[model samples]
Target: MELLEERIRRDGVVKAGGVLKVDAFLNHQMDIELFSQMAEEWKRLFAGKPINKILTIEASGIGIAAVVAHHFGVPVVFAKKTQSINLDGTMYSTRIQSFTHNRIYDVIVSTRFLGPDDHVLIIDDFLANGCALRGLLEICESAGATVEGIGIAIEKGFQPGGDELREAGYDLQSLAIVEAMDPATGAIEFRS
Candidate 1:
């Protein structure tokens, strides 16, 4: 987690509208080694949980989820941002508002991937507004799956999302928590 925090401090960019762009290594160009290290940390965090599957939302979540799934020895299921031809009639869908993009997307997951027997661990690249996390939770609920836990790479603690989820009694873990950011000064404060 320290490694991730350091990476964010070095490469992450703070912009207006509370956006922290980690495009250099995380949200854009991929860093497999760092991802592997993160996966190991998540594995340690959820060591005893019955994680049968890894669930995530598409676009940014897929790569991180895939690497993490390797540690769990399970398949990765990513919720689709749009309705795709591959997805059949039976699917769990929810609407999510993106804090970064400032748009709502109808996210969907195939019924075949999730079910009552599954113990799911949701993974994502960032936790901003918690909309994506809520949508994934809804999908798990629809499938009657037990949520083992939620793992996030980075969380914007200044946002209400992470606090709201924690207050809701969910077991959530974030690698790097940004307590505050100053765009003008290019300063980022991490939670101690």
Candidate 2:
């Protein structure tokens, strides 16, 4: 987690509208070595929990979830933002608002990939508004899967999402929590 915080300080950029662009090393372009390290941290954090599968929203979260899944020796199931022709059968779906794109999407997961027997670990890159993770939680609930934990790469602590989830009794772990950011000065303050 210290490694992630340092990396964020060194490479993360503060943008207007409370956006922290980490595309240079996360989200868009990825750092697999760093991700592997993060996976180890998450594995340690969720040790002894019954985590049979890793769930995440499509796109940004897929990379982190995949790497983390490898550490847990579980398959990663990502909720697709859009339904595709290849998808079939009943699906668990929910509407999610994107923190970055600022749009709402009907996120879905195939019923075959998740079910009542699964103990799921939800992973994602950022927890801004918590909408994406909330939607994923809905899908898991619809499938009757027990949520083991939630792992986040970077949490904007200045936002309400992380606190809300914690108050809701989720076992949430975030590697880096940005307590505040200054778009004018490009300074980021991390929670101690």
lDDT (CA) for every model shown?
Answer: 0.90, 0.91
Model 1 lDDT per residue over 1-192, tens place: 899999998999999878888999997898989999999999999899989999998898999999999978999999999734444578888888876667878898888889999999999999987888999999999999999999999999988889899999888999999999999977999997
lDDT, candidate 2, 84-137, per-residue tens? 434355888888776567677888888999999999999999998788889999
In model 1, the worst 10-residue window by lDDT is 82-91
Runs off by more than 4 Å, candidate 2: 83-89
The lDDT, on a scale of 0 to 1, for candidate 1 is: 0.90
Tell me the deviation in Å of residue 74 in model 2: 0.7
Which runs in model 1 stand beyond 4 Å of their true positions?
83-89
lDDT of 1 at 189: 94
